[model samples]
Target: MEGAPQGTGYVVNLDEKLGRIDEHWKPRVVAQMNDYQFKLVKICGDFVWHSHADTDETFFVIDGEVRIDLRGGPVVIRAGELFVVPKGVEHKPYAEHEASIMLIEPCGVLNTGDARNERTAQNDMWL
Candidate 1:
């Protein structure tokens, strides 16, 4: 099995990889090793309120601001901020303009959480 990178991997150009993302609200897996996977998602507007039943989701804001509504306690994640939504806590993500985010989660995380919606993707798109 391939091991995780010890440090930043200089071989892959992130800008070139980011160029492959063309769809909004869709997440594409960019890197994976062991039980972890890295995904890039471009988002705008309000997303459906939901939560993962099994695994926690971590969001790292790459660019722009994203507001995560946690029902009673909401937080605004700006560029360079990282937030983790604990498993089974319902939350909604919104952005006024296009925002780029990176997600760190175990493989097989469903973006839409428990409730299936039009945003639920059938397969993990790689970009």
Candidate 2:
């Protein structure tokens, strides 16, 4: 198996990686565990409504807060907290200001699910 750097197989500084990003809604792959990928992204304003039909998505807040608008209601995820949006559940994510967050999901999952558009980012993008 391929090992990582720093003699620990992996050592990703989330703060450092987050500082390198300036775009919104674009997730940068930071690490991989088995078949899953851990991505860091900066979010603000409103995101497109979408859902992962095949797999659930875990949204973990690193800084600031995130609000996910679901058909039933809205789910607020604060810093140091996490929320999982189940597969096939239509939802839209929103953040008042720039929010640093991490998304844990299987590799190759699209940022925008069924609502593909210009906001859809290419899979497997690393920082």
Candidate 3:
């Protein structure tokens, strides 16, 4: 099925389509545009502490639990919960167990925030 001219494409059997992603610490782009994109990431362990100086990033917990360490405090988000980190706020995300998360942000958002370590993935790998 085709997508609407001004909307995201119609998703048919998302669970079936997403069954291909099984690795940890890898993200897959589900949709994109000139300035923004939607990504699904499988996370476990501690990510780097960093900040996005130009754009806010939104994270929605799809499964399991995730803990976001902010500059002054920490927020634990479970499945169905969402959080937004405004631009320039130093934060680190971690999950003791495997967690699936969806991120909404401007295109070119560095997965590793500002750290730019080897964990930073460059390709816009689509699922």
Candidate 4:
């Protein structure tokens, strides 16, 4: 990972970091602050419905568009927009085409949240 040297916070180019990812739904850690981590991922199609019990999940759309389905309704997030899924609220994200996004959440939070299944990704993987 090419990052800024110690004592000097460097810049992380979102487009550049996102280009390295090829698989959908696999989040790669790009940066971290305290106990929170920033992850980049490419997503397509529908995701499993799940919720984080202890923490909220933030999604920043970088490219394309995404639809987050909630019990109450659905929210559409386009490029350069962001959305936060409240803690314990079930949400499923979907995209008609491939989309690049960043997820900000506490360290060790599972991608599948409480719905662990074949879609669960390994945690703390750095880019």
TM-score of each: 0.87, 0.92, 0.86, 0.93
Candidate 4 regions exceeding 4 Å error are: 1-8
- Give the C-alpha miss distance for residue 62 in model 1, angstroms: 0.4
What is the per-residue lDDT of model 3 for residues 31-116, given as tens digits with 9 covering 90 to 100?
76656877788889998899999999999998899999998999999999999999999999999998888888887788887888
- In every candidate, how many clashes are there? 0, 0, 0, 0
Ranking by TM-score: 4, 2, 1, 3
Kindly list the per-residue Cα lDDT of model 4 for residues 12-94, writing each as its tens digit: 78888888888999998888888898999999999999999999999999999999999999999999999999999999999
Among these predictions, the greatest lDDT belongs to: 4
Q: Look at candidate 2 and give me any clashing residue pairs.
A: none
Error of 3 at 34 (Å): 5.6
lDDT of 2 by residue, 1-105 (tens): 123331126679999989988999988888888889898999999999999999999999999989999999999999999999999999999999889999999
Between candidates 3 and 4, the lDDT winner: 4
> Candidate 3 versus the native: TM-score?
0.86
Off by over 4 Å in 1: 1-10
lDDT of 1 by residue, 3-53 (tens): 423323535545566677787888877777677778888899999999999
- Lowest summed lDDT window (length 10), candidate 4: 1-10
- Ordered from best to worst lDDT, the candidate numbers read 4, 2, 1, 3
TM-score of 2: 0.92
Give the alpha-carbon lDDT of every model: 0.82, 0.90, 0.80, 0.92
Task: Candidate 1: count the clashes.
Answer: 0
